[model samples]
Target: MTGYDQILAEVCATGRRLTRAELESRRLLGERAAETGVGLRVLVRQHLAATRTIWPTLGSVDADRVLAAVEQSIDAFAEGHERAQKLAVRREEAARREFIDDLLYGRSDLGRLAERAVRFGLLLTRAHAVAVCQGGTPLDDTDPATRQVESALVARFSERRVLLATKGGLLICIAPADQEEILAHFAKLAHAATDGGRVAVGRAHPGPGGIVHSYEEALHTLDLAERLALDGPVLHAVDLLVYPVLTRDRQAMADLVRNTLGPLESARGGPQPLIDTLTVYFDSGCVAAESARRLKLSVRALTYRLERVHTLTGVNPADPTHRFTLQTAVIGARLLGWPQTEL
Candidate 1:
């Protein structure tokens, strides 16, 4: 029998449990075998050599029978070792999955774990904000430029401790600090990295529990930036408060719109047809025929009114840049109950 099997049988015969010291001694011997550049086969041979000494102390038995039992025990221990290795690997995988989930979902307890991980991995003591980056038009292209940009961000922000994940046309970044210098660095990187790109940045909140919050803010900012057609290489969360204002304080929005455009409303008939044309134009999706039909005027009259609008507002209705401004003004006016003073 193999050494392990013989040891097991001797324990059973003696009705005794091995001490911790004995286990340690055996483990040390195994390690020495490894240190000696011994293969498993050679290690097993050495182990059997030692076992031979112990076997004689037991009552004499057929050498063949002893060898068979020793072989059986060796097989059992190998099986046990393999099972242990599998369990260890499984445990590690589970931990990694749990870590990712916690980072995404914002668990309170997991927040602590995140802090520990960051401090341990990135040497960050505390973080005040997290910034997630959603790749813009140019960055969205699967190219070397994107990877280079990501690498640059990581290297530059190593002190700030940045984590980057780029997948499916999205480049997610987690920036731990909210310092202006750090944010400005990000903006500069973005501007340099992608051509005609856009970046949505979230506001800074308290760190530790702010990763998920920051992610949400980045998403919301991107939506707002896109809707408003804002100029960008960078867009901030604060710039998108107009939509929320429209939703929550319609009267306030209307007031602002009317205050801003009230003069145009009053001057519509006097060299400016802005207020009336805007009302009709927006209502009809800027369609000349529809606006003309609604206003009971010829398309020529509608075009004339639109020209006057451009002159008064200093915004060309046909330009994409002006379209966003017009939309926001129209929405704001609608929300605030416009035409404060009807003509």
Candidate 2:
């Protein structure tokens, strides 16, 4: 508004559109206002106020021409303002992305990371949990589905502590561990928004490094779900902790797999069908009928498969005494990717 009065007076007196230089100056002014956090409405109002002040000063002029000039000036100003705002948003987004990477990966000094977390409305001092959603299609922050989830979560929670991001084509949600509802709601929204993906939640952990651990746990849950053929759409790391312990000793698990089920490889169909029968049987709580139903096999056919397995492996699938060993070996085989990757 400082020099706008003189420009408005010129346009009113001459009954012409704003000169290129004047319009450029107006654009520059708009950019400055945006940079300084001025509202667009306020900027527009100032220009209109200047126009009103100058209107009386002009002895006689075409109202249409003066109106056109003012319109052009304001439009130019708005264009510049919007341009600057967009630039700012991009810069902020980039910073946010960088901070997330460092925070989640523990790539930065803990002190520095904690300070940066504060800027994003996160207090790294409290317990936090990470929930990851892996869908059929890869997703990113810019994806429409991602934005919708982000919007819904923001609208529902309104707590800045909850953050939604995408990493490695997976949707990630971080929320305070104390607020279990936030993570639960996020899992709900993410499952609905994504393409029938599985959502895994890591157990709550305390401190900044805990976030990294939780993120890793969530990621591992997805991996475990695939390896173990888990069908649940929502998985919690806590429920699957035993699997990790079982595989902690790679050699032990491998040896168990090799010794327990290795003989099945010699059976016709190369053990896969037998292995499937065993897995389904164990999963069905050793219920022959349920396992047969799940496998779409006749009861006699499933019984024959189980007998074949027992004959080949020399371990009874039905004996309560042998069930634990057989089940453990089956789990090990899945975890070690035995048949597919070789013992």
Candidate 3:
């Protein structure tokens, strides 16, 4: 209100509206106030007080003229204040986006990243777990569904150190390793808000690099779920650790798939139907009735498929000793996307 006092007094005495230059000066003052963290309401109150103080001294001016001048000046000031605030918000958002990208990808200097992490409510020194949601529709920061989850998370866990963001078209939440409930609630909210989606939680690891590891694990869990056609909507990387181990040696897994299930390709419909039978059979825990029910097949037809598998593969899927080999091969096939992927 440095220039505001003089301008208001002059307008009251002269009974004239502010000139364009005077209004522009007021706009600049408002921008400065906004940048310096002064509340607009507070500034407006000060202007009103100044107007009242100058009112009696500036004798017999046009009351309507002074009021109009005051209104025009305040509007210009508010417009400038809002413009400055909007710019600040955009800058903050850009910085946050950059920080998250660097933090998750481990692309920046660790010390720098750790320092930046503090600004975003993260302690890079502590262990963190990442949970990712992959749904039918891709989610981003601007999505209402994503914002709802973020708001819910912040409301319930405001004191906790957590960050929710979007990466690779998926919603990602990073939380302290010890705060499993945070990830769990994030998954719950994500499922509800997104209509339906798979949420994958990665095992917690220590330090900044740990976040990268956990993020990768979460992403891999989602990928594995898609590749394996897993039924569960929520997947934990720790529980699915065997998948990474199984796929560690890609060629070996491919060979196992090709060797164990290769013979079934000679059947009338290629290997897919037989592979499906084996998958359902193994998934059903050798329960022929359940497998038949799941596959919508008669018991006899299911048995015939089993027998056909035994005849072609030379191993009885029902035999306990052979079950291990067949089941392991079936899992490898699914992981490698055997028939569809030329494995």
Q: Whose TM-score is greatest here?
A: 3
lDDT (tens digit, per residue) of candidate 3 on 1-343: 6777678778777777789999888889889989999989997898788878877876787888778877888888998898899999999999999998898889999999999999999999999999999878988889999999999998999999999999888999999999999999999999888888889999999999999999999999998999888888799999999989988999988888888899988999999999999999988989999999999999999999999999999989999999998898999988888788886
User: Model 2 over residues 50-106: C-alpha lDDT tens digits?
Assistant: 888888877677888778878998999998899899999999999999998998889
Tell me model 2's lDDT, rounded to 2 decimals: 0.90
Work out the TM-score per prediction: 0.45, 0.94, 0.95
In terms of lDDT, model 3 sits at: 0.90
RMSD of each: 11.8, 1.8, 1.7
Per-candidate clashes, comma-separated? 9, 0, 0
Model 3, 101: alpha-carbon shift in Å? 0.3
- What range of 10 consecutive residues in model 3 has the weakest lDDT sum? 1-10
Pick the winner on lDDT between candidates 1 and 3: 3
lDDT on C-alpha atoms for all candidate structures: 0.59, 0.90, 0.90
Q: Quote model 3's TM-score.
A: 0.95
